[model samples]
Target: MFGELEMVKALLDERKRVVVLTGAGVSAESGVPTFRGQDGLWKSFHTQDLARPDAFESRPELVWEFYNWRRQLVAECEPNPAHHALVELERQIPNFLLITQNVDGLHAKAGSKKLMEMHGSLWQVRCTKCTHAREAREPLPDMPECPVCGHLLRPGVVWFGEPLVAGVLKVAIDQIGRSDVFISIGTSNQVQPAASFYQLAKDHGAVTVEINLEPTPNTGLMDFAVHGKAGEILPELTTGLRESLS
Candidate 1:
C-alpha cells in the first residue's frame, strides 16, 4: 500500500493530464445512501422502479415523490474529506477532469469546477415536453411544470435504461484518452461505459489506479489498487501531492 501510494504521488507530481472517475461509494462516505442492495427499497417499491422513464410516464407524481425524498436526503448530507481532496487535486493539476456517476451534487458543493456529473444531478430538473432544464435546488412541487412549455418536469438524472448524455460521455472519453494518470475511486465498475473507462485509459498508455473499499472486477487492470475508505486515503494522497510541490 505504501509503495502504491508513493507511485501515485509521483504521477501527480509530474503535473500530467489526469482523469478521476467516482461512483456511489464516494458519496456513501458522506452519509448518502446508495440506491442498490437492501437499502434500495422505498415504500415497498424498488428505487430502480421509480427511476425509470416508463414509471415516470405512468405515474409522474409517485416518481417525483421518490425524487423529492432523495433530494431532501442528499441535501442534508455534506461533502466528506474525499470530495475536498479531489478539489485540491484539481487545483494542482492544470489538466484534470472529474467524471462522477453519483448525482448527489456533493462534488460541486465541495468546489470541483472541472466536474462532469455523467449521471446528472439530484438538484436539477428538466422539462418533459420541450428541451428545457435547469438546476432547481429548492423543494419542487409533487408535479412541477415546465416554465417554458407548461408541461411536466422530471428529475434530470439518467435513468437505468437511458443512455448517458452524449456530450458528457464524449468529453469524459476524450479526457480519458488524453490522461497521463487515471484514477477510479469508490466505483464498483459494474456500470457500462464508465466501467470500461480505465481500460481506455490503459490503452492510451495512462497509469491506472483504483481506490475502493474492496476489490472490484477491474482491480486487476489497475497499476495500483489500494483498498480502503476513500475519505481516509484521498486526503493523505492530496497531502503527499502538496508536499511534493513544496
Candidate 2:
C-alpha cells in the first residue's frame, strides 16, 4: 500500500521506453483462475501433464476440453481496472510495450496497441496437421477440422515444453533491453522467461516496479514493490501519471 499513483507517475516521467510484463495475477483480478497453482489443472490433472504438447498430441480432445473451459473463462471476464490503466499508461507514455503471460486477451480488450503476447492468446485457432498460420478467432463447438490440411483445430496458447514463439520473444527481449522502466503487474513471478524479463529490464538500466497483491517471487529485485490488488492500484497510478506528466 504505498501510493502507486505518484511512484508510477515518477517512473513514467523519468523513463522513455516502458516495458510491462504481466502475469496470472492481473487476469485473476478479472476472475480467471490462477490455473497453475495448487488445486488447479482441469479436474485433478497436473499442470505439467495437462498443459503440455505431449498431452495435446496424445489426447487432443482432452486438451480441447481443458482449453475450452479456459476460453469460456476468458470470454466471461471483462478487463479489470489494471488493464484499463495500462491502456491509459500506453497513451500517456512514449514507446510503451505490453508483454503479457496470460492468454486471456484482456490487455488487447483494454486497447493496448503495442503488445507482445508471450503466452499467446486463447482467442486464436491453428491447424494441427500442416501447422497453418494462426487466425484470431473463437474456438468452434464441433471442433471443425482445418480447411487446408484437415487437422484438428486447437486453441492457440503456449503449451508446456513449447518455446515461446521466437518472433514474439525477440520483440519482448528487444523491448525489455531497450526500456528505461519495467512494470510488472499481477504476476507471481514463478514462471520462467516472463519472470525473467523484469530482471532483464533492470539489467539494462530500467527501474523495475512490481504491482501485485503480495511480494512476488522476484520482489527482492524490484526497485518498487507495491503490494495490493492491481485493479485498485493501477487506475490510481494512471491518474498519477496524468497529474505528473501534465
Candidate 3:
C-alpha cells in the first residue's frame, strides 16, 4: 500500500487532467443498497422488469413506487470519507472531473463541483410529457407531476435498455480522452462503456488505477490496483497527494 501510495502521489504531482470514476461500492459505504443485486423484487414484480421504459410506460405507478423507495433509502445515508476526500481532490486539482455510475447523489452532497452523474440522480425528477427536470430532495409522491406539463414525473436515472444521456456521455468521453490520470474506484468493471473508460484513458496515455475491495475482470489491466474499502483508502491517498502537491 505504501508503494502504491507513492505512485498515486506521483500521478497527483503531475496535476494534469485527472478523472475519477465511481460505482455502487462507494455509495454502498454510505449504506445505499446495490439495488440491482437485491431480490430485484417490487411488490411481487422483479425490479429489473420495472426499471425499463416499457415498465414505466405500462405501469408508471409501480415504477414510481420503486424509485421513490430508493430515493428515501439513499437520502437516509450520508457521504463517507471517500466522498469528502474526492471533494478535496477536486479543489486541489484544477482539471479534475469526478464521474459516478451511482444515482444516489452522495458526491453532490459531498460538495463535488467538477462532477458528472453518468447514471442520473435519484433526487431529480423529469416530466414525461415536457422537457422539465429539476432537483428535489423531499420524498416524491407515488405519481409525481411536472410543474410545467402536469405530466407524470419520473426518476431522473437511466433505466434499463436506455442509452446514457448523449450530452453527458460526450463530456465524459472528452474528459477521459484529455485525462493524464484515471482512477477507478468501487466499480465492478462489468458495466459497458464505463467499464471500458479506464482502458480508454490508458490508450490515450493516461496512468490508470483501480481501487476496489476485490479484483475484477479488468483489474489486471490497471497500472496500479489498491484493494481496500474506498473510505479508508481514499482519505489516506488524498492526504499523500496534498503533501506531494503542496
Candidate 4:
C-alpha cells in the first residue's frame, strides 16, 4: 500500500499547504496508553467514564487520579522518530499546521512550533469556576484549587459530552479547508469533527493520506492509505519528501 510514496512526494514537491492531524496511535509508539485500549481500565472503571464532567463533579478525586496516572505515564515517554520527522516537516514547509487529538504534550516536546492540541494538553489546568487556564508543570493534588477562583481545577481537555474549544476547532478546520495536502496519522477516524476533517480536506481538493498501523473507517476515502507504524513510516515518508525537495 505504501508503494505510492512517489505520488506523495510529488505533492510535497509542489510546496502546497500541508496539515497533519495525529491521534493516540502516534503517542502509542512512544509507550503512552490509548484511551480505549484493552489496558485502559482502572479500578474497574472505564477510562472513558472518568473523563466526563459528570464524573469530575461526582468523583473529582477519581478523575484527577486517573489523569495524574496518565500524566506520569506520558512523562515516562519520549518523542519517537515520527514526532521528530513531523518537526522537520514543519521546518521544511512554509505553510504547515500540526493538529493533534492527543492530550499528551509529546508533539510540543519534539519542537513542533505551529501546533494545535485540539483535545487540549495534559500539562494544563482549567479553573472549574472561572474557566481560566494555566500551564501545569508539576503533578497536582487530587483536588487542586484554582488560585484564580478558589474553585477546583480540572484537566484541560475536552471531555465526553463537552464540545471541542471553538478557537481550536476553527483553526483546525480553517487549515484543513485551505490545505492542499492533509495527512492523518495514527487516528482511528471514529471521533467526529476530527474524523470529518479528512473528508473536508478531500472535498476542498486536498490530497489526503492516512498513515496508521491498520486501515480505519476513513481509509477508503484517502488518496493513499499506508498502513504501518507511524514511527517508522513517517520518518521514511518525510525523508522521501526531504530528498525529493533537495
Candidate with maximal TM-score:
1
lDDT of 3 at 191: 90
Which residue pairs show backbone clashes in model 1? Answer: none
Using Cα atoms with residue i matched to residue i, what is each candidate's TM-score against the true structure? 0.98, 0.93, 0.95, 0.97
Full-model lDDT for every candidate:
0.93, 0.82, 0.89, 0.89
Off by over 4 Å in 1: none
Candidate 4 lDDT over 142-172, as tens digits, reads 7899897799999899998999887878878
Model 3: per-residue Cα lDDT at residue 199: 79
Listed per model in order, the count of residue pairs whose N, CA or C atoms clash below 3 Å is: 0, 0, 1, 0
> Which pairs in model 2 have colliding backbones?
none
TM-score of 4: 0.97
Clashing pairs in 4: none
Stretches off by above 4 angstroms in model 3 are 39-44
**lDDT (Cα, 0-100) at 179 in candidate 3:** 95
Give one digit per residue, the lDDT tens place, for model 1 in 1-246.
788888889888985799999999999999998877987999999998889999999998999999999999998999999999999999999999999999999999999999999999998899988999999998888889999989999899999899988788888888899999999999999999899999999999999999999999999878999999999999999999888787
The lDDT leader among the candidates is 1
